[model samples]
Target: MTRSVALLAVLAVALLTALSSIFIVDERQKALVLQFGRVVDVKEDPGLAFKLPLIQEVVYYDDRILSRDLDPIEVTPLDDRRLVVDAFARYRIADVNQFRQATGAAGDQSIAVAGRRLDSILRSQTREILGSVSSNDILSSDRAALMLRIRNGAIRDAEALGLEVIDVRLKRTDLPRENLDATFARMRAEREREATDERARGQEAAQRIRAQADRTVVELTSDARRDAEIIRGEADANRNAIFAEAYGADAEFFQFYRSLAAYRASLLEGNSTMVISPDSEFFNYLKSDLGTQ
Candidate 1:
């Protein structure tokens, strides 16, 4: 009976110790067991785990992707342009041993403190990189290259803290509100001046074209008039020539007929003629025998 009672006590104690050794590993967590204040083992797998009861302690940490948003920082571009940058970073603990050694069992304290230090470090690095680049370069789509360089630099600096930065992204970049208004004013003035100059040049070109067209119209009208005058003069000369030829073929008949036409045109209707002697030279043709016939 005494032997059985001692064996039962031992089994009860063992059961109690076994119950105390029970631990859990979640899908996103990794744990480290410390024996006598020294890291004895690390549990990286999920599900139920056991450790030396009342002698070992467990430290749990997240292994999933973690992100932190940094504060706003000022960066100066190569063109002397000032910009405000707001960014965030993604990271995951890659080396558990290094993480533990660097953090010194501070656990979550490292992340909270890192958040502050990283803000200052990133701000400084951002200003350095931005100061080396032009404003246009920073504003361009290729600024991703600059971002990659900064992220790599951050990763190198963060290696001492056992933090692995997966990527860094710039969320917003903008000029200060005080400078924005001034910039817009200057841009508006420049655009207005350009528009005015363009309009003036267009008007000048149109005037030149219109003047040239008017000169051409005048030249065409003058040329047509000269040609028409020449043609009319030619027709008049032909008619005169025909009359002269016809008259030259019979001079005496032409003279007599012309004088009679002139007398008929000068005499008035129903008037008695009271001229000089009828034997005048004007009446010589009338006195001739041909005139009598």
Candidate 2:
């Protein structure tokens, strides 16, 4: 019975040993086998992997793309205007061996270490590239091109840390809180100044148009008066000519007509008295048979 118990204990120890020596590498992970705290073998392929029990251990690193959010950074543009920028980056560990060596951290802590190191690299590049351009370029659709430049600048530095920088993006760019009021005030003042200039131009045009209209009215009035005076003088001259022609054509008839017109003038609605010599020529027309036709 004691022999059977001893054999059972021996089987349990072997089973535990076998379980400890074998490890599974997931599809999403790459494992590094270390003996006595030194890297000995790498197990990148998924499936079962083996290492000496109680002598070697395995450390796994993610074999997939990762992301990190960088802290907000301030940059002064070419115009000396400062802007606050929020950004993030996407990266992948291309060389686990180099990554482990560069980070000098074991287990999951190395991932954190990589992220912190990448932050510094990206921040420096972001400041350098963004500062070289104007604020308008950073705020406009050209921002995409600026982000590409920043990513390119960081790529070289990231490679030294065994990281491949896939892309970097500027999430938000804004004026500093203190500058907002000043910017808005300046914009408002500019709009008002433009409005004033436009109104002045409109007024000047209106005045010019009014002056032209006034001049037209004065010219037209003077021209009409001169034409009326000419017409009146011509009518008077034509009537005088007709009278002179009639006098020349018949002296006796014209004299008789003139006497009759004077008679009509002397006689009025009331009784009229007129003393004249009987031999006077005024009586000639009355004396005759009512005057010639």
Provide the overall lDDT of each model, using Cα atoms, as 2-decimal numbers. Answer: 0.81, 0.91
| TM-score of each prediction | 0.69, 0.69
Instruction: Quote the lDDT for 58 in model 2.
Output: 92
Model 1 C-alpha lDDT per residue in residues 8-67, reported as the tens digit of each score: 999999999998899998989888888887888888889999999998988888889888
Clashing pairs in 1: none
| Cα error of candidate 2 at position 254, Å | 20
Q: lDDT of model 1 at residue 31?
A: 85
lDDT of 2: 0.91
